[model samples]
Target: MKLVKSQPWRNPDTVLAQLIQSCARTRNLDRGKQLHAHLVASGATPSTFVANHLISMYAKCGDLYHAIALFDRMPQRNLVTWTAMISSFSQNNKFGDALRTFSSMCAAGIKPTQFALSSAIQASAFFASLEFGKQMHCLSVKLGYDVELFVGSNLADMYSKCGSLVDACRVFDEMPDKDEVAWTAMIDGYTKNGSFEEAIVAFRDMLRGGTVVIDQHLLCSVLSACGGLKAGKLGRCLHSCVVKLGLESDTFIGNALVNMYAKAGDMESASSVVGMNSHGWNVVSCSSLIDGYVEMDQIEEASRAYISSRRQGIEPNEFTFSSMIKACASQAALEQGIQLHAQVMKTSFVRDLFVSSTLIDMYGKCGLLNSSIQVFDEIQHPSDISWNSIVGVFAQHGRGKEAVRALNRMISRGNKPNHITFVSLLMACSHAGLVEEGLEYFYSMNKTCDIEPREEHYACVIDMLGRAGRLEEAREFIAGMPFEPNAYGWCSLLGACRTHGEKELGELAAEKLMKLEPENSGIHILLSSIYASMGQWEDVKAVRKLMRDSRVKKLPGFSWVDVNNKTHMFGAEDWSHPQKEEIYEKLEELMVKIRKAGYVPFTGSMPCNLEESLKERLLHHHSERIAVAFALISMPATKPIIVKKNLRVCVDCHSAIKLISKVEGREIIVRDNARFHHFADGMCSCGDYW
Candidate 1:
């Protein structure tokens, strides 16, 4: 593999030029060094022309040290030499060096060409230096190079990177000719700024004009824009283009296709793309599938996908692990979450910002607050997300004062509180019956933190006041909002009304909520509960009949318990368990003990009017009771029982569980849709506020 010295000498310059080109293309560092030796032995001083090519050759081969040394030794410097050096710095991710080199070139009284200016603009964009980018733009305008295709595209991208989408669009509009590069830059800018509609418009213009060829990269960006907008029709159009261009085998496009379909909620298409061998499924494709499944609330399916990913050699990356952890949190799978944490600790992603934050959330949702606190304490420098997660966990567990203290510490560390931080703080105050503190924080949202309150913030305020039994004040606050309250606001008031036994306000809130969210069958149940509380059996029957007429079916209440590393699910009056008879017998014995301890079942909890005996029987067989019965019989008395419920615990069950916890001398942790309830010694951790 050695180069011959005695070669044709008729055209020595052309031969050396060809050799350098060949070396640059093939990245043959050895042959490139040999060519340098031949140049030195020929006794011909390297001209500016030959030196420029040598610098470019070394730079393209990824040998930046040699490229810089050769450039410094050159007796002469030209525009191409400066451009190549700047590009070399940029390609190596040394953006600061690239900018410094450009300054040096300017000090030498050299005029920059279009390519040199473009490289400097790109460096500014990478650093997101808005002022520096403006200076470069002014210089380009003064030099009459701003209109050039290469410089124009770089300027557009630079503005976008600085988060100035308006300026980016203005620069794009000023360009005389629109090329594929220009279109791609504009599309990327809109997508990055969350202007999905504008991005779609620009892409449509590109297709109608037909002046520029749509390359795979341009199409990829547009597909992402479509996904953001959930424009599945447009995505299918792009998919067709991908097939027509025969770019289906391209790995990057294949991943984008899967992501687009997943985000659009077209799971069938996304799964099909992954299943096709021609699409070249990789780690990203599988990760997208997992995320999509989580978004669809298919936690079990997401877990199966994670297992399948591990069976293959494709190791899960940060995004993969984070998505899987979220799935576990949603399912309340504590054992699986602990296993995943062990796997994460073996990799560097355990310390990653997103993975660490997600781990805290997963542990908190699993009723493992100690583990959550440990994860939070171990973070060397927590970001806003980490702070929010810790504060939220404390709030969710009914530790309101602790959450407030954590927020104070977060601010003391020089981290500014955002809207999400305020939300967590407000929710904490609400759950702990701190109505005054919650109101103070809600009012301070705009004045102190410069954060305008959104609908969610207003909803939190309504919930806090309502939970405190201030029903009239809550209604007045809703009436005084800048805009009509959303469904969440009305639903919060409805929940509060139900809690405080205000049938009139509850019915009004239910009317508004029904108008906004007619398909929400949970609203009907809440209204029925309100009527049942007032002894209006006919009104409850009417509500039930309306539901039946409309075919509105409520989600059945389900509970899950993990024992011996296996999760068991139970539905209302479920008798499918292998030890159903034993569970019932144990429940009967517990009922006797609870009755002797002054436990009386609240028959009003039943929405339907039935015989007193029938209502009591139905209340005895609720899903949570069945799950608790199984846990009490299966596990040791010293161990605490944790049950996860899909719906809120009814008043009858909540009352029964409290007495049972005291009778059996066991701690029971129940996590419903909204928050955690810890029952011990005949008292609930929520303080009966929820």
Candidate 2:
């Protein structure tokens, strides 16, 4: 539709402005310019409104230069033109330019409107520049924009994002009236910044005042923060809110409910939330269920959920791949992971960083390092996740030197390492007994990189120092921690104490461990063993009585191996297999042959239990013992035997495996919670560090 020109008016300025409006309404900047030229040629005085619209057209059409040029040429301008320029700069992410524009606008003797001030505040929020945001807030009130709801919301959000929730509340309360957006901004500010309790408080106030309705977005925000906390009471209370609102079947809320319950360790609640749905498995809901199952280590359940997700016609995204790959890694299900890899290749997300990195991690953990490396190389630009995954794979393989090489390569390529990168490096150093390297990296993590060390980082350092027999240093380090020592930190020291035969320190560390895990009998047993090793047999008897009295038993150790398309499982002293007799016969013969080749029994392992002779028998039928025997029978000689253990392999087993490695001239790789020990040619990669 063509814009009809307004009739010539008694006010020539008004007639020129009308013609300008007609040109602006046409959205033809060229025509507006031509009309402006005609007005200038006709010597008609320009009105502020005409100039403002001309500025708006320049700003709106992504022509900030023309906008600024027009504003400079105008004899008179209003706050609208200034607001338009500032907002345009911000919308283009020219934040510095926006700030400069605001400064210039102020210098031009025009007080900014709330629209301009709010736009500047939002830019501050994006950069987390609260000082600037605060200045804007002060100006807002001085300029009479503080009472505006949108302005207040922007200021509150900026304050909250800068970790100043108190000021955010001050601005929020200053508003005489608030809209849903204001309420959502305040609530989201708290929730996004991890202030869940405060969010709940504000939400409750909103409910009581009837200020706003809790929508699905608000519920998801609160529920995400609720996931890390064990708040079954609060979770159930939130469930009641959902029920009252009749939002139980809402896809997003249902997904959030699943995550909240799953993290609270209420699997029944989590399962019920997902089970109630027949075919409402949208991408968000499907991913949440998959995450819940993986977090619980129900790999098979996660797989079934993945299948159901595909059936529901919601295509999987990066998060879905992350969850499913983690499931296969935890289960060590290589075949299923391979199938998933094929599917990942077919998806449009094949090159996505998250999807590819998880795939690398899964394949690496599955002992397919070549596959992991291939995927890593295929990445156009690897993220820290990709680098960390490859490095972790090397560390897990007892390839500390290779891991360090990989890390160095990443750094050489200008890829900065994060906490995960440092973790993999520290782990590699610990496994390879590179004490000095671990120390250097630990110090560099904070001093050079400025990555504030978390408890896990400190725990790795403690474990490294302890494994290196620097017990005093480890104790001092723990004492110097800014935060209280956690279970992992103390547990690492405890493991070191046990390793280095520091019975006194071992007892002290056990005390800490016992406090952290009150019902844990393993720490008590380790303390008893340390005492008995030092000839305090009475204390050993006392610990035995305590364990029996507490009715706490040691966790059974199990091992599984795959060969000839069949999986074999072994438990400690397990003679349940039909071929047990034959297995024992072969073991007896191999032991005799190995002993003839200078192998001897290491009995220091037996005193953890009461009977010395029975302990020897138990060691003879231990899981690793059974696993090695099965390897000899099932696989050919000269092939390396890899065994993954649930816990650290015992000292006696370590020595026995070394003897076997030399006697049979075979390589055996044993992976446990602490590190990997590769026995080859009578040497273990740990170098007796274990």
Candidate 3:
């Protein structure tokens, strides 16, 4: 420093003191070296204070090699010197070195300071080693540093990071003086562990205590909790607090606000927050908006926002590309996704695990399974998520045996199969009607893989058994479940019963479903359809009465198809299209051709108790049928038609589409609420398994 150089009249100790302080503050390594030379020339005994400051300066500057060299050459050392070196390694992302240095300090018989203890505990968290963290806790207690505030806060954080939330809470509870940093750490720990409600509660307690200063970091943690819990009212309250506290101008706080509203499903508020803020869009803001749109199923809006953001000069990161590509998958816009894929390949982000996995999902959802496999093959050291994505795509495409082979391969490659992997495998077997195979996999989950079957796995097993006309065994399996079956398990059984014409068991499963989810209109509708299929008109009327009494309404079925880069949506009996007349005419002609090709009007799946003529007429107006009719009129017959539905395809429409696909000599791909169905030459990919 010039201040040190100009002080020639000052004593050597005073000059060295000033220089060390200046170097530590600014992390000026060159000046620190010059000062060290001056210290040597002065011939003064090198004080531990001066050495510690020099080491801290080097460590803070990320020159760990210099810091370690200085430490090793020190004639004497103190707690500050050891702590400075450990923190240097910790801050530079060399967590293993930090831990080893702490060990060396202990072996050197130097008692640790509170700062050293905190840095060592934090390094354990960064390492994500529970054993090391517990050892640190034991050491903290042994050395009488466990009760210190800084050490306590770090212990809480370390436990949470190691997935020991209970111990974290215990540490927080045992703390005597919880300052702002301590409280913030606890709240963040709760949020990190998915204890959103507890995080909010802690925030409320912190506010009521009024002893700590609430800063931007604290506000961001609470906002994240609100978002995770979907507590819109609380989130709005936090928004007000941000305004009152004058934090609205902060870009990071603004990003948190956007995330809170987006995760709360209030995208209108989220977009308005983004628009009103003067802060320009960054990667986080753009990614938040795109991800929110995808979560809301607003694929078109996500596309527009992505394009607009790129025009505004904000480069998309891996998260942004992943969200946008998933939106393309949802829209089944294969061409748009391909263009995005090209952009990704041009950049280094194509190698990112999330982006690559999303590419596979996009191709699979768009019915480009070959392209999906190609992407899978190109990935280097694919994570379990990548493997699961490819396996899921195969399952969705109705390739059960191949999916099983992939699962085995994943295991052989040393990637232990998680619960999600088995879920994919069981789903594949269900889609392919492999009842026995599904059963074996379900059992193997616990016996071989040591993975417990969650409710979804049981649902798959039920669906598999029900698909094969083994409704009785499916019921027995549910009764024998280790835990109470969730609503999905019962709903799957009901759907299977409806498919297999097991009216009695179907009624039982529907009753169970209604009791578990009385407000679910789909369950009531399924029950009504089951009764109608059995020619029980009175039961259908009773179910309808029950629905009316409960005031539960079914979601109106709608189907969407993309053509020429534009998406068009159609609902049952829809007449809002400008080409309605032409669409209706095409539908009539197609009906005639399919009828001539031995396609009978099937109304057994319709829930309404009406005359045969009216039922058949109503079936013709189903949303998917209308969407297909419109597609046939709007596009060439040689190109395949892909339609996405909001609910399961009715049996009548499915059968009708199969015949139409054969008669029109066109391939028709339909994605219902559950899986994809590709119909060609009067055959469906599901092979009537569903």
Candidate 4:
């Protein structure tokens, strides 16, 4: 705004208006205020046109207070004046005020311009006010602005944000000319509303139309849909498109690409995207990588990513901490989880609902139920997720009664138990052998809670009955299921049959499992174990031969213990550890002591037809035993020995651990694939049920 220093301007008001527009464009609030003062001091009443620009300048400068004051003082306001004020409120996130102003404009018989209607529609979208949005749509139609590209695009956006995709699509289709913004709104709406398939279809249609130029925003929305569907092939195709479009350098596009690749389980591609991104990793990209690694059960990689992000000065937000904690939970890495918990406490996310719930779960899975309870108790206002996590903690620890009490408490706090709540509840009952209570809860899922029982709920019931040794009832329940029983149901029955030494039924369950999952090594292993328990060497040989013929390799069972912030893993009879001599010596010493305490090695299911001494030797050297031995040698006696296994603890090892705990006078907690076993005072927490 160069001043007219040479002579007085003939059209001073016009020059002032132009200067005010310049100030608004630059967001120069100080200059805008100076011009306002000049207008007041010149003793000339500015016309409505000039006044409108002043209002716009103030609004654009973010001085809403002055904008509103100026608006209130303006005795004559036209469409531009009202539009500027309404847009100001909308832009500043004063959504309710924007809508109110829109209403007042309507009451004043002021027909809104496209800009005003778009701002009001955006406000409605932010509020998710479908009814108000519909009214706005109607007004746009009545004012013959519905077909206007700007207003129609906003209408579609509002509908989508309100979760009314049908209406959004209708508006989008009725538009005379759909631009990139309109198509982007519809696609984004579908993606946001969980209609991933529909979103993809719309994106395809937009591309097929070929009239609208695709932009980064449109690509980002479609990529999100691909991620949701885990459509890796399509995601790769989009990656190629991004490269060709030269949008790969864009920060937002880079973040979206990382998220898509991560969600699609292509961590290699995801990591490359992060590396290739010119802007480098931010919290969003780093968190997505961590989450992807966790989902793939690569806890070590996830932890490394977390550490690398921190080293690069990227702070972990709630999602990052949550994913890392979840990774620790998956591996039962209690020490690492504890370290993450401390880190979370240092950040403001310690009290975040998702992070807190993840912390509770990590503690519970690591066999620290007390820590989980403490975390839950610290939550100021527990959400359903947090409540469910606490209940799940009790369930994981086999505390059925406490889980029920937690559920009651959750309900009392006005939080409804969702489907996840009942899953944990049913699991608790199953682990505790509360058969009747488990059945009651399973039935109550649909009757009382309005949550239709999913397949997982039915599987829990079967598991409950199977764990109670009610094989006949469990079979009947499966037979009576409305839908075909899934693999979990059959697996539960087979496990129970193996536990109770029911050879014929175990064989039958194995047959069903073979048809359902022909390559499942666990089924073959379980069946072979059942045959071995019955001393049927020929049948065991047959199963082993079938595994070899099908090329189905059994996953080797291993146990790992964290000592001094490092993990030591062991397999059955493993001699791979650097301290194998010490571990074995300690294990042999403990075995001798446990045997003195009347611990007899139970090798009924040792598959190999070997001498009694060799079988007993094999049983004594199971992976969990080796892990516990290592923990006892390396960890302090005051600390409980926590060993995590990839498979269920064998009955022989379970018995030996009970006696070892008593003889050594040290608590040993073994977390296997199924559940936790707290061995102390010559007893197990499962009471020998597991």
Best lDDT goes to which candidate? 4
Best model number under TM-score: 1
Off by over 4 Å in 4: 1-14, 100-114, 129-148, 170-176, 576-582, 592-598, 658-667, 673-687
Residue pairs in collision within model 4? none
Q: Report how far off residue 292 is in candidate 4 (Å).
A: 1.7
Which model is ahead, 3 or 4, in terms of TM-score? 4
What would the per-residue lDDT of candidate 1 be over residues 217-263, giving only the tens digit for each residue? Answer: 89888988988988888899899999999888887788888889989
lDDT per residue for candidate 2 within 1-690, as digits (tens), equals 122343433465566556666665666778777876776687865677777766666565556787777777877767887787788788777888888889998998888888889888988888898888889888998988986988999988889888898999899998998877788788888877788787777777888897576777777766766775656778888888888988887877888888788777677787778778753467776787788889877767888888987887778998898889888777556667788889888988889988888888777666666788899999999987789888987776557788889988998888888988888788788877888888788877787777878877888888888888999998888788888667777777776787677877787888888778878766776677677667777788887787788787877888775555466888988988778888898778767876786766656634464577676777777888788778777777845676767766877788778778887788776766545666777777666656
Residue 171 accuracy (lDDT) in model 3: 86
Predicted structure 4, TM vs. truth: 0.91
- TM-score, prediction 1: 0.93
Give the per-residue lDDT of model 4 (tens digit) for 1-690: 456564356477778888899999999999899999988898887788888999888888889999898899888999999999899999888999999999899899998888899999999999999999999999899988997899999999999999899999899999999999999999999999999999999998888998999889999999999999999899999989999999988888888889999999999999988887557588999999999999988877988888889988998899999999999888778878899899888989998999999999998877788899999999999999999999988887778899989988998889999999998999888888888988988987788878999888898898898888898888789889899667887788888888888888788889989999998888998899999999999999999999999998988999988888788889998999999999889988998898899988778887888999999888878899999988888988887788888888888889899998999898888888767887887877665655
Model 3 misplaced stretches (Cα beyond 4 Å): 1-11, 23-51, 61-79, 100-112, 204-210, 481-485, 515-521, 542-556, 571-598, 607-621, 629-640, 659-667, 680-689
lDDT scores of the candidates, listed in order: 0.86, 0.78, 0.86, 0.89
Q: What lDDT tens digits, residue by residue, belong to model 3 across residues 219-301?
A: 99899999899888899999998999999989989899989898998988888888876683777877888899999998778
Q: Each prediction's TM-score against the native?
A: 0.93, 0.74, 0.86, 0.91
Evaluate residue 188 in candidate 2 and report its C-alpha lDDT on the 0 to 100 scale: 81
Off by over 4 Å in 1: 1-11, 589-600, 636-640, 658-667, 673-687
Q: Model 1 clash pairs?
A: none
